[model samples]
Structures are given as structure tokens and as C-alpha cells.
Target: MNGKQKQSYKYDKHKQRLFIIPARITSNVNNDILVIDRIYDDDDGRVVVLDREGQVKWTYQGNPQVNSGDKLFNPTDIVITSVGHVIVSDVNNHALHVLSGEGDVLTCKVMEDQGIIFPMSLDIDTKGQLWVGCHSGDDQRKDAKLHVIKMSF
Candidate 1:
């Protein structure tokens, strides 16, 4: 093999052959693997956190408190904050989800009023600022803009 041979393994502890579509991935300061499970079926999108040993630590489907009327349709990207919180860009929901290190839903906000068309990606800088890139919801693609928000933690 040109690259290092990588072994394949399943994440689901119950189902031996359950398939997982990992769209985006990142590692926390603790070396935990955070993955965005993008299954295109009856099931909604979810975020799976795994330990260094490939063991499933916790899974976050969506934040009910923020998404009271909808499910986590499509999570495009994820970034772990300095405090170990996982921030996800909920594309279809038009929202940003903040999850605690242990997979608890800390907060969720739909930023439609803030001119967020379709947030597709995000990252945190050394100064603790969040930069969000969005796809234009308008047909002409003229509404696309980058959003910068100062993050405390």
C-alpha cells in the first residue's frame, strides 16, 4: 500500500456489522475522536465521540431544547473548542450546536436572523474566535458571507 495500511472497525457495540458514514472528523485535546455520522435514511444525523482505543464514548443526535420542532438533519462540520466542547454546524437546521465534552447538549442556536444562510464549516482561532463559513441560500450565491463570533469558552 502506498499509505499506511489502516484497519477497519465498527463503532456500534450492539450491531457487529452496522455501517457508519463518517463525513467529518476531529480529535479533542484528550485524543478522543469526534465523528459526524451522516446516515441518509430514516435516522437523523448524529455525532459520535470515541475514545483513543476506538471505543464509543458518547453519541449526540441533536439538542431537543434548541431543536424543539426539528431533528438534526445534516451536520456538515465539527470543531472542538478549547474547553473541550464540540461545536457542530447543523446545516439543514440552520443552527449551531454546542455539546459538552461528555456529549451533553450545552446550547443550540438557529442564526437565521443573524444572516446565516447555510453554515457549512467552522474553526476556532488561537484568540478564541469562531469563524464560520456559509453557503449562500440565495440562487445567485451573492449572499454568502463569513461570520466571526468571539467565543468565551
Candidate 2:
């Protein structure tokens, strides 16, 4: 071995099949990973969570407390805030949904007016702000824009 100390870095390649849309990924403070479930035509889809060891914890399926009205869609991408709140991009309905730990809708708002057509992915910064990636359909995909929605809670 060289006299100089070798600073080594390594990453674990633990794979777990949880969500459909595996294009984007985010990690919580606890190293829990959140991935997009799938991409839909009209709205956001679902987000799945995986523990540090690459084990499925529990998925937040679009606010489990909200009663389905027969015209509701699931979440596309999810973000776990520093405060432990789950933020989801509810695409089909053209909105962003915030849920509590137990999967209850804490707040919901239409992100379409903000040029958010179909939110497909989400990312959270150190300051706890949400970065949203929207898809305006394949025809306009080349012009798709990224929306940054600042979380209040």
C-alpha cells in the first residue's frame, strides 16, 4: 500500500421493485428512497418508498384517507420534507397534494396554472422546497418546463 492514505468511497447497489416510474429518485433524511410509480397521460401517478436497506416500507398511495370519488387519480412523484411530511405531485387531477404521515390530505392545490401540466417527478432541496418536473405531452415534450413549488409547511 502507498504511504499516502487512500480515501475510499463506495455505494451499495441494493435494488427493490416498488414503483413503476423509476426515472426519478429522492432520499429522505433517514435515507429512505421515494420513487415515482408511473407516468400517466393526464396527471401525476404514484410514489413508493424504500428503506435504507432497499426494503419496501410502506407506500403513500395518494392520501389513503381521501375517499375515492370515482374520478380521482394517484400521485406521480413524492418528496419527504424535513418535517416528515409527504409531498406528492397528483398529476391526473392537475394538482399537488400534501399528506400527513398517516396518508391524510393536508392540503391540495392546482399546479396547472403554474405551467404544471403533468407532474412526473419531484425533488426536495436542503431548505425543504419542492422541485417539480412537468410533462406537457409527447407533442410538446421538447418544450416541457420544470416547476419549482415552495412548500409552506
Candidate 3:
């Protein structure tokens, strides 16, 4: 078998829209594909989850209670934990959003309170610690930080 497009999902929950811009995608153990769709130039976006059949399972448009105004959901990267939970990087909001495998918004972990900002990338360690690769938002300083956080939920 050569290179061939299996299925293209432009819009979630059906129709083709191509609304996803610069998408970051990953698959969980359940064969569900998680995509981080950066929609706007301002880094505003949402996470779209689809099944193996290329059908939209559910869409999480950010938790309204936690995200609004300047602090909207701007997901840049995504990863599925060992337990099948989804962790999304909200760089602009300096936070990480944890979603259930079914696309339910579980918790919003605000990293700013713990002195972490611009959480760009994520990975889970062998010991189950979430490693966050971050970059300083300051234009003048091109610095980076790595944080390991152990979470339970």
C-alpha cells in the first residue's frame, strides 16, 4: 500500500469545513483521534475528537466557566495519558486542560499560579508526572522551562 488519504475531517459532528488551522493530532488507546485545532490568529481554538470511522464523537469548546474574554481556550498541543485522559496546552491562558476520553472537560489546571507560563508542549513520564515544556512569553527573552507535575483526578 502506498501513500493514500484515509479520511479528511474538516468539520466536527459532520460536514466538511476545514476550519482547523495548524492542527496537532494524536490517537488514544481507544482509537479515538484527538485534534487541537488552532482556529484564529490570536491562538483561539478548540479540541475536536473523532472516532476511527472519521465520525465526530464530541467537541470540547473550552469550559465557559474558566475561559472567557482574554483568557480563551488556545490549545496548541495534545497528549493522551495512560488512563486515556486528554491533556491540552492552553498557552495563552497559561494552563492545561484535562478532558475525559469521551470529550468531557474535566479540569482546568492553571499553571500561572504555580509560576508556570506558556506551557507549549506536554509529555507523561514513566512515573506518571506530566512534563510541560514551556517558553517565556517575553519577546526580549528567549528562555525555556521544563516542569514536572504529578496529578491525580
C-alpha RMSD of each candidate structure in angstroms: 2.5, 6.9, 1.9
Query: Which of 2 and 3 is the better model by lDDT?
Result: 3
Model 2 lDDT per residue over 30-132, tens place:
7667666554433435566666666666665564334156435556667777777777777666677786654466887776676788776788878776888
Provide the overall lDDT of each model, using Cα atoms, as 2-decimal numbers.
0.80, 0.65, 0.83
Against the hidden true structure, what lDDT does model 1 obtain? 0.80
| Model 3, residue 141: C-alpha shift (Å) | 0.4
Task: Give TM per candidate.
Answer: 0.85, 0.59, 0.89
The number of the candidate with the highest lDDT is 3
Q: Where is model 2 more than 4 Å wrong at Cα?
A: 1-60, 63-72
Candidate 3 lDDT trough over 10 residues, lowest sum: 11-20
TM-score, model 2 to reference: 0.59
lDDT string for model 3 (1-153, tens) is 679987866664546764557478899999888787777666689887778877778888787766887777888788888999999988988888898899887888787989889998998988888999998898789788999998887
lDDT tens per residue, model 1, 18-125: 346888889999988888887776336788887866778888877775544655456889999988999999876788988889988778889888888588899999
Strongest candidate by TM-score: 3
**Candidate 2 colliding pairs:** 21-37, 43-91, 43-92, 44-91, 44-92, 45-75, 45-76, 46-75
Which wins on TM-score, candidate 1 or candidate 3?
Answer: 3
